[model samples]
Target: MYRYLDSRPAGNSSISLLARAIGKIAQTEGDHTTAIPALTLHRRNAPTKPLHCIYGLGLGVVVQGEKQVMLGDAVIDYGPGQSMVTTIDLPVVTHVARASFHEPFLGLVLTLDSRHVVQMASEMELPQPSRGGVYRPISIEALDGPLVEALARLVGLLDEPALLPRLAPLIQQEITIRLLAGPHGSQLQHLVASGSPSQQIAKAVAWLKQNFTRTLHVDELAARAHMSPSTFRQHFRNITGISPLQFQKQLRLQEARQLMLNQDLDAGNAGGQVGYQSASQFNREYSRLFGTPPQRDVRRMRAN
Candidate 1:
């Protein structure tokens, strides 16, 4: 166990309380999405295998235990008093790295609305970044005291239904502003800036996600983003840490997993629907990525 988990002094009292509140909320809500708007709580009693999904732009603070997210070759590990920020939607592998029945993992996730960020920055006169700056779509940083308190208050609202309607928006706005002023400010600024690489790649990413089943053509996607094939490929990899074809492959596999789990389609049918033509090829790729054949993975998920 980490020493910090056992040592919660006066300085970390709010964080300690926040962990308790998050755990209680997660217990009430189970592992499913709750009725608390964009707020979601997660509690895990044990470590888990790497799970792949699209991580949206959001603020996540681990009040207890730890987690790690893998993007290409980059591995980001965050623990208590630290926060994870994702500026764009990207497919990644993630897992709970540290947790146990005696001290379960507890955390909070809040979605970031770009519209709200723009409105708040305009109202506050926050300075925009220069025209060209490199950006990382995901980052981790220490949570300042005020940010931690704000998140705690936001989660605290879940207990008071009446206060939520009036107070939730204000707290969420505060969080966005704080993030825009923090170390990742330039990244967030470029997110809203017109014609920025981040914004351009975002358009391409959206198109790929919606049309993953179709054959991919880099030139066509580059034309859509107003970039040449080479430039588009470079910027796309910089922002998403994966090439366009790889991104589409992830989307296809994730969709196939859903079809198998929810719709109860056989492996061949599910793979075919996601653009896979050969059953043997689908089985090999599925096993390579998921560590098991599609049927076995789905059955394990159901059993648990």
Candidate 2:
């Protein structure tokens, strides 16, 4: 069984308390989804290899241990008393940088609702995010006292499931309000503000995610976002840390891997399912992204 270090120094009390609450429910090494919608508890007893996935809009708080997220050429590392907010769906390579059997990594993620953010920002009448400044969809901020306390209270609600359905939303709202009023607020504001470059690029990203298997036409996508192709390309890369075509390819490759691993589909069929018309091209791209041939990678993952 995992035990929280109650004897830890008072300076770390808030994080330690959150870790204790997480340790109680997440006794094993994996993601635990709670009855509280869009909330997930994560536990890892040891360090892990790089795992690539799409991180949707959410707030991730690390109560214990450390991790890193790689986006294109950017690398972000965060640990205890730190939180990360991703304002858009982004493909990232993430791994635990620090963890141990005795002191496992513990964390939680709460999905953010864009519509709710827009509603709150409007009511608050916060100043518009500065224009033309490149704001990556993800950012890190040290957790302040009030925000940390609110997060701890949110986890505490699990002990009283009867009150969760009613209280969870209120707590989640508080968390959102804090985020909007905090350092990362500018990025969230950029996401919802009308006609902002981030907002326009976000719309294009949504369409690409939904139609990853379809052929991509940069001009058409740019027009959809109401920008010239050149401007759209620049802003897309600025916000997502990759070109639009690269983003779609990553989405395709990720879905293909999932299909192969979960449904036991063959490489060629999986490739076709994810918009790859040529088996050779798919093999080359798959090997490039995953560091191994499709079959070999699948076998290796299963063995692990």
RMSD of each: 3.9, 5.0
Question: How many backbone clashes are present in model 2?
Answer: 0
lDDT of 2 by residue, 1-304 (tens): 1111111222378888889999999999999998888889999999999988999999998888988888877888888888899999999999998999999999999999988888888888677777765586888887877888888888889989899999999999999999999888988998988888788888999999999999999999999999999999988987888999999999999999999999999999999999999999999999999999999999999998
Let me know the TM-score candidate 1 reaches against the reference structure: 0.91
> Model 2 — which ten-residue stretch has the worst lDDT?
1-10
Give TM per candidate: 0.91, 0.94
Overall local distance difference test of candidate 1: 0.83
Query: lDDT tens digits, residues 1-304, model 1?
Result: 1111212222468779888878877774235465567888888889988999889878878888888888887788888888878888899999999988878888888989878876766676667777666677887777777888888888888889878889988998888988888765777777877888788898788788788999999999999999999999999988898999889888989999999999999999999999998899889988888899999999998997
